[model samples]
Target: MRAFPAVAGNETLRNGLPGGLYSLLSHAEQYRLLCRRPDLIAPAVDELLRFWPPVVEFRRTATRDVVLAGKEIRGGDKVVVYHASANRDESVFPDPDRLDITRAPNDHVSFGFGAHFCVGARLARIQMSALIGRVVAELPGLELASDAPPKRLVSNFQNGLKELRIRWG
Candidate 1:
């Protein structure tokens, strides 16, 4: 009973952190920036979280009747909120498709929003920051092993890599 929350949180980090790191490595320009500027690790992590969120979407039951996007959603309705799509909203993020590590005012919904927001969001950020920083410092020559794009986990629920081959000197 007591260990359930801890295990759940660990699972989230396990799934999310690697994908975030892989996302950084896939983009050559961003990876270069991380190598050059250690200070940018935090922002880079945030941008990665926004650009390639691990959890693609989550289902929630609506508690009250509400009109969203001019569509009626009644109480007890099952709604699937796509956080990844929301993070890439053109109206919200300028040049949404581009992975800008320096993106400020980055109010991304990667860790979710409002009441549904993740309780371990801060811890996740810290862990990502440390990992990115260490990888940049230690594996300066790290790069993708193949020119071909790495395979992704084929699942509607998780946005993660099946494998990300890399080599470092």
Candidate 2:
């Protein structure tokens, strides 16, 4: 119930990985892995969150009456933060549309800006990087097979490839 799908604009990890994406990690192991790789962690946690957003959209209530973006809102007003859209904000990420793997100091909002960040951020990165690294080391020129286009999930909420046909020596 915690994880969701990526969007059209959020395919960095998907395109970065080999054979498409693999699997999701449970909550317990997620924290354990992050704790292990303390040196290589970053807002890349943000990237994974962007790549595999937990919730398509989330709702929040205003703690106090306030006005936002030329709109007036009373206290307890409901607000929905689209994590996916926030991750692609041009103001936050220069050339937000581009998927640069080496993007450093990336403070993407996909994992929530503050304390609300995803719990499994660490494990997701370890698994993802491991897969990507394996492909690069084990199979150079690895690419999608030229038989048929990969299948789609048919749901925009979940941006995932149903299958990735690949061949490599």
Candidate 3:
């Protein structure tokens, strides 16, 4: 029997989409802004992607020996790249922790980078933008149903919420 390989591309929709939605909805101020200005949906989606990248981290083999942050890594050493950390790097993103929907030049690595960049990145962005746009238009009154913290998916590889309780009048 031939074992089927995991369809990693689905992660963009399965994990990424929901994660982005939850991040936006949970932040009431941001949600209201998007509802008021539909034109900001695209950038808002990008910010959401950066703020909570679904693929938390990925592993790759180093091609050459190098010293990173004082640690020497030999060729072929396994290196873990944490997308979440890179997205929030203060040097790259000013006031990184705060979500700025209008942030320009948002060179976030939520979709990976270089040769390993995700092919479905454009599709992911479009999907996020469309979904967010529709939500803003149709559910302007939507809000978190509870003040309790959301239940997050317990996986080091994926950053996502298990459920986001919401209500609309």
Q: For residues 79-134, what per-residue lDDT tens digits would candidate 3 score against the true structure?
A: 99999999999999999998878888799999899987887788888888888789
**Candidate achieving higher lDDT, 1 or 2:** 1
Regions of candidate 2 where Cα sits further than 4 Å from its true position: 1-55
lDDT of 2 by residue, 50-153 (tens): 54454456677888888877899888889888766876878777876654443575776544556566555555566666664454445544444567666654
Worst 10 residues of 3 by lDDT: 3-12
* Residue 101 miss distance in model 1 (angstroms): 0.6
For model 3, the superposed segments whose C-alpha errors exceed 4 Å read 1-7
The parts of candidate 1 lying over 4 Å away from their true place are 1-7
The candidates, ranked best first by TM-score, are 3, 1, 2
> Quick one: ranking by lDDT, best first?
3, 1, 2
TM-score of each: 0.90, 0.61, 0.90
Residue-level lDDT of model 1, residues 73-101, one tens digit each, is 99999999898899999999999999989
Reference-based TM-score, model 2: 0.61
Query: What's the CA RMSD for each of the models?
Result: 2.2, 9.2, 2.5
Best by lDDT: 3
TM-score of model 1 vs. true structure:
0.90
